[model samples]
Target chain A: MVSTARITRQEAEDFLYEEARLLDERDFFPWLDLFTEDAIYWIPIEEHSDPTRATSILWDDAQLRALRVHQLAHERNFAQSPPSRTVHSVTNVQVSPGDADNEAKVRCNLVVYEVRSGDHRQLGLGDLRALPAKCLYVLRYEERWRIAHKKVVLINRHMPLINLSFLI
Target chain B: MATQQATTQRGYAELVEITDKTFRVSSRVYREQEVFEREIAEIFEKTWVYVGHDSEIAQPGDYKTAQIGRYPIILTRDKDGAVYALLNVCRHRANAICRENYGNSQNFRCPYHAWTYRNSGELIGVPDGGRYPEGFSTRGLSLIRVAKVDSYRGLIFASLSADVPELDEHLSPVKEHVDLWADRSIGGEHKVLHPHRYAYLGNWKFQCENGVDGYHPGIVHESAFSTFGEFGIGNFAARDLVKRGSISRGFPGGHSTLEGGARDGRGVGRGLPHRAEEYQARLREVYGDDRAQEIVSNRHTFIFPNVFLFDELVRIIQPIALEYTEVYSHPFWLHGVPDDFNTRRLYEGTRQLSTTGMVNPSDLEMFAANQTGLHARMEWLVLDRGMQREEVAPNGERMGNYSDEVPQRSLYRHWAQVMARTEAGR
Candidate 1:
């Protein structure tokens, strides 16, 4: 199910990289602009599990995503007082034929090395974490490619996960 | 002054000091390795620790692995359809038999020596049995079953002590609350979905104590509710119910609950999307309007040692070390409910409970700080809030206001009672 028309491999890789860069640099609102209003951001609880019947690590509509972004930017977010810093190394972008026209399923692998430091009250300090996931993106081309649905299947989905308050 | 007890051994009187008027817990209980070890021996081994829901191992040969105070155990259904909890340690060589977290297998073969055992706990193969003596029988070598196993409304529990009380007796105290939560469904049935688990550098008791802690929500999650209020996302009015009007109760055997009233039913009933409305109608049809109203009330339940039914999520807190805890959060889907309604439930469950969840990470930060800060000279942790307002019920449940410390007292008192005994009761 390879998408050979309308978009090229290099274009898709560039989009993924730019998205990762925005997240790494904490350019959230612009990153938020990258998704369509009806976008669904999902991090599945387990690989291949139905988010409708099963819980995902994150299942946010645009409304909840905005709330999340607002929390990260808000001053009183004690969970992010020191704030988590992450570098997303996104790779292996492959475009497949999606179920609809003007939309294609894009697949990529990501490893986000995150560190939470400067925890004076000892809330979250000296903590280094890793988030590895196989991300599936359904991109719809309007003026440019916008994320219609982004589903992240974490490798350590079943393991006890720590906070991912920061965007990845 | 803090008790002079050594950090390696905890005495009964040093850890907890419970009086009729007030209660104080030692910081050592949260920090000391000795108290943690004793807690594992007294609290986890003797109590009816929740293993997994019966629905998790529904089909024959289905299995899931869990831990009980460092003992790796597996809950599996055999071909005959009987549920069993067996220690995952291989009897032949003490190596782990089944390493996978969840799978369907007819037999578990120890990878070290290929000591194969039936999923039913029968030692079916020995790889080479002729090397042993004729009297060295395999009959006594089946995987050791936990001393007791039973279920209360699909919530499975196991005890390492054979003489521990019946599951019904152990669970009778919190059965009503559990029923209230479970009966919200159309069939009084629920299925645990795929779990998201992660470990924090904190004690398991932090999770236990936090389960029924209604007081910290407004203070700790200020940012979360700020946006909730800002976005008009949830029932923002009900967010302050814990601080203003609510009830925290303590039951026998260390079980406790924070009945934060019918105000914040967003996670359960309303203040949600269109799907919840239809779901509520279906629930009302099954349970009538009044009973449905009662069922959908938001509740925080801590079932003694291991389980916490927090809102729509079932969290299992496993203590791996003195300062490390692994928590597994499982969202439940009610049977016969509409797909959209369950979808909303799953969405709300993850938004608050997952690793990247806004609410949980805040609580985890406090717990981590609490664990880290206990090494200070200020050793006594005060749990004296709302102590004088206790109203005891006929069933021995002590009730207090929303911000009351009744749960902490109840939990620590029971912990003291359990640790006071040197051996598991017969």
Candidate 2:
């Protein structure tokens, strides 16, 4: 049985806002640290399907994620110049129960508006799965919740996405 | 200003009869709404436009939505793995039935009303079927199917006109090129790596022109070539080394192919260094020496209207508007080639020509700028480049040098023929 202490909606919203801030600020290293070591970051090429068999815009495990971060910081990446600026808004936060070990799943809707090299793009209505949208970081007294998985399903998943240089 | 105005007026007249000798198309073709509408009806509707590959929707119940000219189409694979292209609008209200881009579903339920359709496009369920007044039969309410759906070696294409020529007849001379890529995939099964699709602010013709325009490599892509040259990497400056006389240019119907030495005969070293040995090995394994050598060292071919089949992958150009075009760059695996070989091809294609590629950005920049420039002035743009060297072929068609505007001229000549025929019929 899991502990019944549920996180408030306000706390979940704040956590999402902070995550978006980190991404918008281009603080990648810290932002990456938010994910657990075994976490999967996915952006499906097709909507409502398994990413394993089909092609996906992004199906990054830790290694792939690291490689993307490395490439973004690399000098030879021509598209990175005039780096993309983004503002992510998380709304409609809802918490649901997870499968195992006192894990609580949180789902929220997200809209990320990004601008790069004079092109403005809107990525709307994505689902984010976090153990707890808010981070407690408990030292000793209680166990803290952190993100175990973050899957973003965009409304226009099949649309030809331009260079996704910046994190959403 | 008066002379310029007169020139513009004359240019519009001149554009209506573009020939094989002309290189620059008249701005009217790209801007005139009348021409755009005619093209949609006559050319797109009459021709076999590539929709998607067979591998995209492999299993039963898998479907993808695509646009053909102005009409939305749903390409789905049935339980038996047969592909079908159906009009996306619901039979009831003409509302799009499958709103999502792609998914696996036993049936498609329209969000507007509860009207449902099976993946095979059958009218499966209708909410409150009894509510229909009297003679409404669910049996006759199926989705409108495209006139013809045909596959050429796994690449599927559909036409709105039933009177259009058969797929093989329309493909005509370009069938060899299609086979070259598709045959490499085992049993004619080629899946797209979910191409890097993006829209460029240019006419679709620009992309077709760019596909066979060998002359632009040394100029428009100077930055990319120069970067490679500076790094002392591949023979980026080998343009002069390629045997100009060895370049082969031919037209099969509206389609054209240009096979020549890359970078002036600097040889088959333009691709990624890591995959060089594997590619050569695979080539040798498949076609032995001579054919593999030809495939590796040659330039690209343009399958008229909008398909570009290069060494590694194919790009299908979908015209969205007069000033905007969407290109889907799909990478395919060559049959019998190692998985590593396909990966290398995918990597090279993605890094160089995909939406986010280094060279593609520059190409898009030039295309956008060209579109902007065309709309800038009222003066006639010259399509007369290399007209002096055009030679009349035995078939009455004209031909030009490898770097000449022969192909573009051929394309527009066909375009005019098709448009004129449609107008005459009307």
**RMSD per prediction, one decimal?**
2.8, 7.7
Residue-level lDDT of model 2, residues B1-426, one tens digit each, is: 544343234433345454455455567677666667768877887778888877778889899888888899999998888788989988888898887767788788887887898877889899888988898888878888899999877778899889888998888666765665554443346667677676766777778877776566666656555555544545544265334543434464667665565422222334445556665666667677765655566557677677777766678888888877888877666655556656645654654576545456556655765776667544456556567877767754555666666666667767767766744343
Q: Mind giving the per-residue lDDT tens digits that candidate 1 earns over B206-267?
A: 98998788778888888888888898776644356765467899987889998767543454
Best by DockQ: 1
**Chain B superposition TM-score per model:** 0.95, 0.88
Listed in order, each prediction's TM-score against the native is 0.94, 0.72
DockQ, computed on Cα atoms, for candidate 2: 0.12
Candidate 2, A123-155: lDDT as tens digits: 111212121122222111024455667777766
Top candidate when judged by lDDT against the true structure? 1
Writing each residue's lDDT as its tens digit, candidate 1 over A22-65 gives 99899899999899999999887666767777667788889888
Model 2 TM-score is 0.72
**Candidate 1, TM-score of its B chain:** 0.95
DockQ, every prediction: 0.69, 0.12
